[model samples]
Target: MKGRFVTFEGIDGAGKSTHIGWYIERLRARGIDVVQTREPGGSALAEALRELLLAQRMPIETELLLMFAARRDHLERLIRPALAAGQWVICDRFTDSTYAYQGAGRGAPGERIAWLEAWVHGDLQPDRTYLFDLAPQLAAQRRAAVRTPDRFEREDTAFFERVRHGYQDRARADPSRFVVLDGEQAVSTLRVLLEEDIVTLCNT
Candidate 1:
């Protein structure tokens, strides 16, 4: 059987990360081979780029280019091979993040982002993307409670609001590929919903 690509997406502190491990365990219980990873940093070169991305403050164009550059390396070095080996791949973030963070949050041109996305990995897309939706102010509070903020995470609420809307718009445009979840929901509740979705995905 061919492997499925699953990705978790959301703005900082939207609680998507908390569910990935549990979701992987659930897949394992059913005997599925799974490879869990995250974007901006998956392969060695990608990881090095990730550090620069998270720390440096650069032009939106540079940031956008670097994002796709890391993605290309990640795909060539890790994501592609794992999927070819029939391992289900779960990534923390994907190109949708670029559309949200750079295209929307930073007011970068959408067409340019689309162009880069096509050039880098037009053939691949996550089979399912779980988007955790939340208000920017609430997400900001949650983020403040956690570890130090990264460059993107340090942006103001207005920026995050744009990012959130960007994610929602994409989800609306591609309903078949996105599953938007309320970030404020209880963990147990979200897991129950995710369990049903995963089972359905696995059976398909």
Candidate 2:
């Protein structure tokens, strides 16, 4: 049997990170062959690129190119192989983040992004993408109390708002592939909501 591909997405402070470990543990408890990973990393080369992406200021085009560069390596060298071996891949972020951060947040041309996506990865997408939706202002507040903001995290609220909408637009366009979750709920409640869909996905 083919393995499942699931990705988690949200704004920086939307609380999605709080539940990733729980999902991994719960999915493994259910006897699913689960694997946890993240992008713009998963492979060594991608990880290095991730550092550059998060640490430096670059043009939107440069950002887009670098993201895809890391992603190509991640998908080809890591994600695809894992799935081919029947390991369910749970990723922290995926291409959706590009559409949100670069395309929407940075004002990259949508057509260009679409073209690059097709050229770099043909018909490859997560089976289910969990989007934790929340207002960017609230997300920023949550993030402020945590570690220092990185380059992307340092963006203004307006930038994050666009990123948020970008995620929503993608979700709206592909309803079948997304599970939109409200992020205001308590961590435990969020996990319960996620586990139900996650287990159902594994069973199917």
Candidate 3:
């Protein structure tokens, strides 16, 4: 049997991590064979690379390359194996993050990113992706309150705004696979919306 792959993405402090847990709970309750994971740090090597990528001293280009490298490892090792066994793969972030942070935010060439994605993913794409939408300033404020900033979190507001818009552009281009949800709302409200969306997906 084929498996479903879903990914969640957003700028820092968009509540994706928090809500992903909620979605996992829902899936598990429904008896789905779910595998919850995150990008840049799923396998051991990838997790180690995550620390290096998120370190304060790394250059932006190096960070982008490391992110993709971690993703490549994740796909080949964990993601592909789990999906082949007919398990739902729920990832916290994926290639959309590269386009947002590297291409749009860091001014890398979109064509190059596209080529890399094509080479790595082939026909593999998320069956569904939920983008937690929020203003960059609001997200920054949330991040500041929660914990110390990572390398990307400490970036300037202008960069984050570009990332935000990048996510919007990707979602607009692929509405069939991407769902944009308001991140400013209460957690319960967002959960209800997500539940509705899941019901719609399951029925189709």
Evaluate all candidate structures by whole-model CA lDDT and list the values in order.
0.94, 0.91, 0.90
Question: Distance (Å) between predicted and true CA of 186, model 1?
Answer: 0.4
Candidate 3 has a TM-score of: 0.96
Q: After superposition on all CA atoms, what RMSD does each candidate show versus the true structure? A: 0.7, 0.9, 1.2
- Candidate 1, residue 72: the lDDT equals 98
lDDT of 2 by residue, 55-88 (tens): 9888989999999999999999989999999998
lDDT of 2 at 99: 96
Clash pairs, model 3 backbone: none
Q: Which 10 residues in a row give candidate 1 its minimum summed lDDT?
A: 143-152
**What root-mean-square deviation over C-alphas does model 3 reach?**
1.2
- Measured by lDDT, the strongest candidate is 1
Q: Kindly list the per-residue Cα lDDT of model 1 for residues 79-184, writing each as its tens digit.
A: 9999999999999999999999999999999999999999999999999999999898998898888888988888998999999999999999999999999989
The parts of candidate 2 lying over 4 Å away from their true place are none
lDDT of 3 by residue, 1-204 (tens): 577899999999999988998898888887778999998889888999988888757666777778888988999899999999989899999999999998899998888889889888977999999999999999999988889988889899899999999999999999999999999999999999999987876666
Judging by TM-score against the true structure, name the best candidate. 1
Global Cα lDDT for candidate 1: 0.94
TM-score for each of the candidates: 0.98, 0.97, 0.96
